[model samples]
Target chain A: MERPTLDQIWAWLDQIPDPEIPVISLVDLGVIRDALWKGDTLHLKVTPTYSGCPATAVINLDIQQHLRANGIDKLVLERQLSPAWTTDWISEKGRRNLQKFGIAPPPKDGEHGSYGALLGRVVECPRCGSKTTERISQFGSTPCKASYRCTECLEPFDYFKCI
Target chain B: MADKALFEFLTRIGDTTLVLGHRVSEWCGHAPALEEDIALANTALDLIGHTRMWLSRAGEVEGKGRTEDDLAFLREAHEFRNYLLVERPNEDFAVTITRQFLFDAWHRLMLISLQESSDQRVSEIAEKASKEVAYHVERSTDLVVRLGDGTEESHRRMQHAVDILWPYTGELFTDDETDRELSDRGIIPLPSSLEGEWKTHVDGVLSAATLVRPEREYAHKGGKAGVHTEHLGFLLAEMQVTHRAHPGATW
Candidate 1:
């Protein structure tokens, strides 16, 4: 068997969708920090979106299984917590997918300034793109999201909260 | 020199969050509203997530060939070290809100202090946990104010909750030899140092909520030293039951 290059491994990882948000690949979601070759074994650094995100374990398993299925059997997945995962890491491609899937992608960090960032207070409706939205709760169905309601559309949606 | 103290200190926080996380999890389906149910569960997951990191670190420090699971599931109640304040039951929504508000205040302060820890592991975990806890404090503080200043019934319940829990809060600020050594090494903050800020924060919240601060001087102590109230045993029973029953079971 031939050893896959790091770029090749990343391409494989990019095929793996986030288990919870199946629209975006793990690479675009930014949880897959880095993939490297250490001897015959492949070592990858993965950071969780939320420290307590239940999907973290599934994501790890999916990465391992997907890589193994691709003929790369030796794998090591490391959990990286420092410089924690922020919605800032979600790629432009991933953000579009989230919006297309009826979830408001988080407002970019400096877009809101420190005041809005501190409160995470501004959000546009993912459904109607209306600026008038009120937070339903700081929590949603998942750890990485917050529940919100669009005043214009009257439709409730999830916001991928910025860390 | 501080390895033993560090291990004990890690267990103290690990178990505190674990017990509190379990107690919060009990509100999963039973919260007063659907949004609250989701919110409570989310908070529980975050706390438990922090618990995994803390306990795993504790196991590493102890070097006893124990993993986080071993430390969390195998320990008897007597072997556990957590705060007595965390073990208090969630009597009702008001009580739960009150307890979370109190703990989150101290937790926030402690984490902020710890983000500066000289230990790389400690500081890194603290840096990550600090962000999540920032949200916890915001949510808990908002609720404490709302419930405290709400209608008579809610106000009464919130007041009762605060008064009952006030005594246990004292234990969090009392420092001992472990705290002394750790602070000397710049690994962790002296618990007492956090009290001033905790009080100022809690006071502002209580004021906004229209709740009076308790004047009680007698404080319940000893959860740090592994002395616990009766509530912890039941929590551990339910928490550890699955692990004990299946022993090394994995999905």
Candidate 2:
């Protein structure tokens, strides 16, 4: 059999939705960090959305089972802990899907000031593109996100941590 | 360093980080702002990671049957050797921030000194945690100034929190025999040396926040001796119940 490409592995794994947030795929959530084929066995590197996240084990099992069901019997999942996962890894399509799923997408590019930037920089609404958003909490539904309420849309949403 | 002394010292450090991490993790989904929530959770994660490393080493040194989880969840309230400062209740955001700021300041000095510890494992954990604690202190300091000097209501709350927490800060610098022995053997930071540095860092932040540094008096000690406040029992009851009930239960 011809070797499966990274793209092929990603496509196969795209069917794996996050155990907690089923609305989004693992790829969309940027949890699957790297995938490679080693002969007949496939090695996949995954980073959890948060440290000690309960869903990581479930997600890993799901990935292994999903790939096995697709005829890739030899599967290995690697967990990487460093250079921690960030919201910036979320793809544009993933952000759109997040919005469609009613979870506010991350802020658009050039919105909130980067780290070391001066404070008081406003964070805009991921929905309706409104800049009049008020922070509801430093915490959100998950450890990787914060909660923000949009004045324009009158809705509360999770803002994926930029870093 | 003597094996027993080193073992006790490591356990104390591990216990402090672990309980404090547990306290901070409670705020995971309940912060007043999402950004701050993530930041706080991340900090908690860092501390938990540090706890794991330190506890694992402590377990190794003791050569006892206790694993990290065993040490963490199996210990009774009085058995835990965390500082009194870390065990204080998280009253409000102001109180939490104040507690963290004080810890971060002391921790930075402690870790920096431990970076030169004779024990390789202690040095490694301290080196890694020092970097993370630096960020925690910086963020807490920034928030302290903003809230302390911000609106009238915020200033009042921040000041009140500071006043309430100031007493606990003294115990952080109170070197007992364990600390003295460790410092003598170069296994840990000298409390005397760290006090000045901690004072400078904390005083600078307090000054920026327009908050007064409370004068030192008879500080509450004995958490190091496993004598905790009434709050610790409840905290441990909640934390250790599952582990104590199951006894070696693993998922």
Q: Pick the candidate with the highest TM-score.
A: 1
Q: Which pairs clash (backbone N, Cα, C closer than 3 Å) in model 2?
A: A137-B32, A137-B33, A137-B34, A138-B33, A138-B34, A138-B37, A139-B34, A146-B34, A147-B34
Q: What digit string (tens of lDDT, one per residue) describes model 2 on residues B1-251? A: 33888888887888999889988888978989767778788778878877877888888888876788988888788888899989899989999999998998788778778878887767766655664565566578788999988899989989898888888877777777878888888898767667777788788888999888877566888888898899888888888888888978986
Runs in model 1 deviating more than 4 A are A110-116
Docking model 2 quality class: incorrect
Q: All models: lDDT?
A: 0.89, 0.77
- Residue A131 lDDT in model 1? 93
What does the lDDT come to for candidate 1? 0.89
Count of residue pairs whose backbone atoms collide, per candidate: 0, 9
| Candidate 1 C-alpha lDDT tens digits along B158-250 | 999999999989999999999999999999999999999999989998999999999976889989988888999999999889999998896
Residue B154: error of model 2 in Å? 7.4
Worst 10-residue lDDT window for candidate 1 chain B reads: B1-10
Highest lDDT against the true fold, candidate: 1
DockQ (C-alpha based) per candidate is 0.59, 0.12
* RMSD values, in order shown: 1.9, 5.5
TM-score of 2: 0.70
Model 2, span A46-76: residue lDDT tens:
8765544568779998998888787787888
